[model samples]
Target: MELRQLSHFLAVARRRSFTLAAHDVNVVQSSLSASIRQLERELGATLFDRTTRRVELSPAGRALLPIARHILADARAAKAEISAVQGLLRGQVALGTIQMLTWIDLPEVLARFTKAYPGVEISLLEAPVDEMIEALRSGELDLAYLACGVDELPAALTVIDSDTEPLAVAAGPDHPLAGQPGVRLADLEAEPFVEFQAGTGLQTVVDRLCHDAGLKRRIVLRTTQLELLASLVRHGLGLAVLPVGVAHQAGLTAVPIIGNTADRTVALVTRAGHDSNPAVRALLDLLRPDPAG
Candidate 1:
């Protein structure tokens, strides 16, 4: 009827002696006998045949013994799973990121955490910053990588600035602007640009840069995939503005927008007050700069 009752039943079933089972389970013989009596009364079946000389399993006791053992075992396993979640040993951590993160050194960042808590399994989903924010708000993602601002974050989530990488413009080696020096936005207005789909954080920065430079972009192609944008730039379809780290990782050349030195901060987003959640906290420790520093 209860896990404790089932546990006591198993101990008695295994030992076949009330006196021995009581000692083995650290209970008084009278208490153990009373618990078994209560269990049998609830089930309406006798679990043991008792004699002055010895105790043996009755038909109902024999039938319930194996079942009780299985139930006890399953209960312990469930408790262990819960403990592991608290200990950061066996739990699923759903993380979301923008496409640019696929190009960032996430493996290195993750390695620092995995080495310490290898039992936590990571599930990564790639989504744009906007979509990632939505996912985090909707509880679809346990954590997310995106530019930090939580105006749209559900009341339950927290945002922490993790790191920043400088943004730069990139082009193919054969592009006309490749060798140019100090080329302002006005000089490149005629060239087709490979841009991120509108509404992305990256595109917002690009739009801001173009606007600041008193120029309008000639977007020839738009994509939600950052890697594909880099590939298109490599093929000279158009130039792309991206984080310097991304451009470097994709084996593309990054040219700083002269006088337009823009940078975007990467932030770790998580369910608020889940700092107590071991897995999420472990990731946050890995993401943010050391507070001691």
Candidate 2:
């Protein structure tokens, strides 16, 4: 039916709460509910089955969800295409990233993007890899900058672009391993480790390396905050395996891990086949690395 009704219905479907969905679309609960009711009336199908505790999408609603998303996407793409040909790009892109990602100059990219298309709005959310992936699938995030294993990424999303960085052991300057040119995986067994939260890509690399080496590290600290992880390592609480650039920027000594595949690849990821919009394409272009030096 109407785009606003579809928008409101889609919001409710994703959030599963009329109140919260209303909050998301910036409308009063009654107005949002009325819009959904009108949509269901026009379609002659019950869109949602509500029972106070939670709202579940009815079969008809589930059937219409994808169709609705496509319609909204096409409408937005049409509007954006006309604006782009007129030399103006206008839309909001919700981007997700992991903590302490230093491989790419994101700020510089955003700076130039803003100068070029001042009409566009951008928002960033720093989260763990798994969470970002889920948000991308659910349409909460438009694009994400994250790390992927050497293996293929999940089928739900596709890699638009990527960059690689070496993962090294970071230690305080006074730590014994700090001065070493290359530290063996076995050598780290004697030292306690400062680690990131379990689902993080960096943590995955650290865990995989130790598991492959048949050695278990004694983890002294586990955290999600970058500043705290850097502080713990700075105080000699434990050694950390992180991107070499991040370690160097944090003023810690970085020692290469010996005989291991420890490179972390950070990718520019988005939902597979979700690149129809010009605004998203423009931002993705800016994010891509320049071909020429």
1-293: candidate 2 lDDT, tens digit per residue: 89889879977886678987787678999999999999999999999999969999999999998788777766655655665575545676768888768857888988998898898877676666876776677665788988776355677888877888998889998998877899878766788988888787778877887898777989878986888999899999999888999999999999998888778888888886456556677888887777883
In candidate 2, the residue pairs with backbone N, CA or C atoms under 3 Å apart (3 or more residues apart, or in different chains) clash, namely none
RMSD of candidate 1 to the truth, in angstroms, is: 19.5
Off by over 4 Å in 2: 1-89
lDDT of 1 at 98: 69
Quick one: best TM-score, which candidate?
2
TM-score of each: 0.62, 0.71
Worst 10 residues of 1 by lDDT: 72-81
lDDT per residue, candidate 1, 148-264, as tens digits?
344645666677665667777788888766776646676677888888877666777678778888878788898866778889999999988788888888888887777766776
